[model samples]
Target: MLTRLKDSTPKTLLLGGAALFSVFPLLSMLSAALQPQGSSPAGFSIPTNPQWHNFVDAWDVANITTLMKSSIILVVGVVPVAVLIASMAAYAIAQLRIPFGKVFFLLLLLGLTLPYEIVVVPLYYEMQSLGLLNTRLGLILPLIGLNMPFAVFWMRTHFMSVPAELSESSAIDGAGPWQAFRRIQLPLAIPAIASLAVLMFLSTWNQFLLAIVLIDDPNKRTMAGALQGFVGAHSTDVVLLNAGALLIMAPTILVFLAFQRYFIQAMLAGAVKG
Candidate 1:
């Protein structure tokens, strides 16, 4: 009993500390947001009256409804195309016995090492040349391209874990390659695909820098870009800013919570198999 108690104490402390660390920032933000305007040296104070109405004011000021629509359009456009392209490419890399497949896969892996900062200039110019600059397509194409490397590599790893015998068995039973992949491989890959989709959605939704650079029109701006504008416009309004921040975070938090089970399962599958 003494040995077990001693072992558990340190773990309990560690977990307590981690929980506090994780929640502190959120608590601070909420406290600041609830604080009344012009009440303290820091320009905020603990509200005698907690202004929940500040959220509505922030939504109106930030034009969150329009920004949200733009964000949705970009996310919806990018996620499906990126996943489909990545899955097909990954499947090819994993299953196709093509010459130079390993070399091509290695090149794809190299893409993970290339940061967006390094390629943004070239990408901007490419968009300009293609007459897509400042358009939704401009914002979307770059995100899809940038996300592809990691997506393909992750999906390829998952695909490789699937038993080759299953494919062969399907072939012997008169299934064509496409049918085999669709009927056999796809079902087994749902977890990995779900994981990839959720991750990609989060990344695409929160993207700020690319949206700022590629989109010049305010109306075309995504939620992240719109949030930056909110900060600029309300530098002194702590309540409004925090409210906007919370609203911006809502979709992502909800998405994670909704699909958390699948995310956990997929990550475990990849980790265990890899």
Candidate 2:
């Protein structure tokens, strides 16, 4: 027991150190946010009197209420449709063995290789011609398309991990592929779908370059895009900037914390099956 404890001590210390390293920045940011709006906060400085109202003030200054609404709209518009399309496509590739499956999947893999910046110029031209530029729909469609490669890839992995016997059993019970998908596979895949949805939400929420380029209306921009303007306007006010940054980040953090259990389960499910 002593020998085992000694052996584990190094690993425990390493993990503890890594966790502190990861959390230190967040702690510093929180400390900064608690300081007075115009005050410059040092990393180790605790406020003499914590100003919780900085978050409230920052929200107004950053137009965070509208920014949050816009972000929520974008997330909702993109995540469900993207996850659905990816799931259906993944089902086809992983379960149905669709014709030329290898070729089709390879094309998606090619998308993963191509950076968004490389594609954004041509994409802008296309949206401009369609008169879709500067609209939420413009962001939605492209985001769904952009997210497909990863969403499909992730779902396909989960579907691959699912047992073939479930489909066979459904077929024996007189269910068609579509029926089986609705009644059997989708429910079983809830964890995976939820996981994909969370990832898509994070991606869409933080999508800055695309939102800035494709959408011109500041009011219609995602939270990250608005943050650019917010930061520029408040460049000199470090405390307020940190407070606003935390406000922008809060939703994703809350969402992940809320669904972290399912997220962890989904992550482990694939590995357990494999």
Candidate 3:
């Protein structure tokens, strides 16, 4: 028992220190947020009179309600469709033994290495040609495509980890490919799918550059993208800015908190192993 405790002591301390380090920025932001709306707060200093109303003021100033609606629309459009398509493609590649499966997977691996920035210029022209620019679908379509390679890769890893014998047994029992995938494989892949959904939600919700470039209207942009306009108008007010930033971040934080267990389980299970 003593030896075990000694062995774990360094790791425990290291994790604790890392947690504190990670949390410091949030603590500082909260401190600044609680300051009087126009005040420039010194680093990590607590206000004598906390302006708790800063959040409310910031919300109204930023018109966060409309931004939240826009972000929700983007999330709804992107996450489900993206996850479903990626999972199905992954199942086909990993289990169905489709023609040129390895070659297709290699293409997806290449996609994973491609920088998002490299495609932006071409995507802009493509959207322009398709009359998709300055529209919500404009952002929605690109985000789904941008997320595919990683999502397919992740789900493929999970499907590959599943025993081939189980698939064979299901086929022996007269289940077709779709039935086996829907009933057996899909249920088992919930943890990985949930983790991927959370990641997609985060990426879509916080999308900034594409949102700004593709959508001219700020009201149609994600919360993080809308922040650019809010900052432009209220650049001098640090307190309200921090409050607005935190408010924008609240949903993604809440989502991760809710699904963290499943996310951690998928990670521990080597969700990326192939």
Candidate 4:
């Protein structure tokens, strides 16, 4: 009992510390959001009377409905395209045994190293030349491009982990390559795909920099960009700001929670292999 208690004590402390660290900012934000407008100094304690309606008020004033629509548009457009393209590319790289497959894999992996910030200027010019500026397609195209590299790399690893015998068995049964991939390989990869989809959804949903640079109109801008417009040089509305922050975080949190099991399984699958 003494030995077990000693071993668990440090872990308990660490978990407690982590929980506190993670929850503190959120608690502070909630308190701020519930506070009445003009009731307290910035960064101060909770208001005597908390105003839950501030969330509704902020939603209206910020025109969050339109912002939510824009965010949804970007996410819905990018996630499916990114996943399908990445899955296909990964399948080809992992299963095709094509000539120069290693080279192609390396090139795809190299995309993981390239940061979006480094290419934003050139990307802007390219979009401008393509007559895509200030358009929804313009914003979504760049996000998809930026997300593809990592998506391809991650999905490739997952595809490569699939048993070789499964594909070979399907081939021996006279199934075509596409049939083998579609029927045999894809079903086994659902967990990894779910994990990738969740990650891609979160990244695209939370994207700020690309939205800010690519979209000029407020209506076209994403939640992150819209949130920035809430604060100004002269005055900052803490309650509404926190309310917006909370609203912005809700969809991503719900998505993660819904798919968290797949994410855990994928991570375990990757770890168990190596």
Give the candidates in order of TM-score, highest first. 3, 2, 4, 1
Q: How close is candidate 4 to the true structure, as a TM-score?
A: 0.92
Q: What pairs collide in candidate 2?
A: none
> Deviation in angstroms for 46 in model 2?
1.3
Over 4 Å off, model 4: 1-6, 41-48
Which lDDT value does model 1 have at 157? Answer: 81
Candidate maximizing lDDT: 3
- Predicted structure with the largest TM-score when compared to the true one: 3
Q: Predicted candidate 3: what Cα RMSD to the true structure? A: 1.6
Task: Flag regions of model 3 displaced more than 4 Å.
Answer: 271-274
- lDDT of all predictions, in order shown? 0.84, 0.89, 0.93, 0.84
Which candidate, 1 or 2, has the higher lDDT?
Answer: 2
TM-score of each: 0.91, 0.95, 0.96, 0.92
lDDT of 3 by residue, 1-274 (tens): 9999999999999999999998899999999999987789889987788899999989988989999999999999999999999999999999999999999999988999978789999999999999999999988999999999999999998998888999999999999999999999999999999999999999999998899889999899999965776798899999989999999998999999999998888887774453
Ten-residue stretch with the least lDDT total in model 1: 37-46
Per-residue lDDT over 148-265 for candidate 2, one digit per residue giving the tens place of the 0 to 100 score: 9989898898888888999999999999999988898899899999888888898999999999999989889889875787788999899888888888888888888888888888
Count clashing residue pairs per candidate. 1, 0, 0, 0
Q: lDDT score, residue 114, model 2?
A: 86
lDDT of 1 by residue, 1-274 (tens): 9999999999999999998988777666676666665433243345577877777888888999999999899999999999989988888889865688899889888999998889889988999999998899999989998999899988898888888898889989999888988888888888788888999999988988888888889778788876888889988776778878988988998998888888777778867876
Off by over 4 Å in 1: 1-13, 39-48
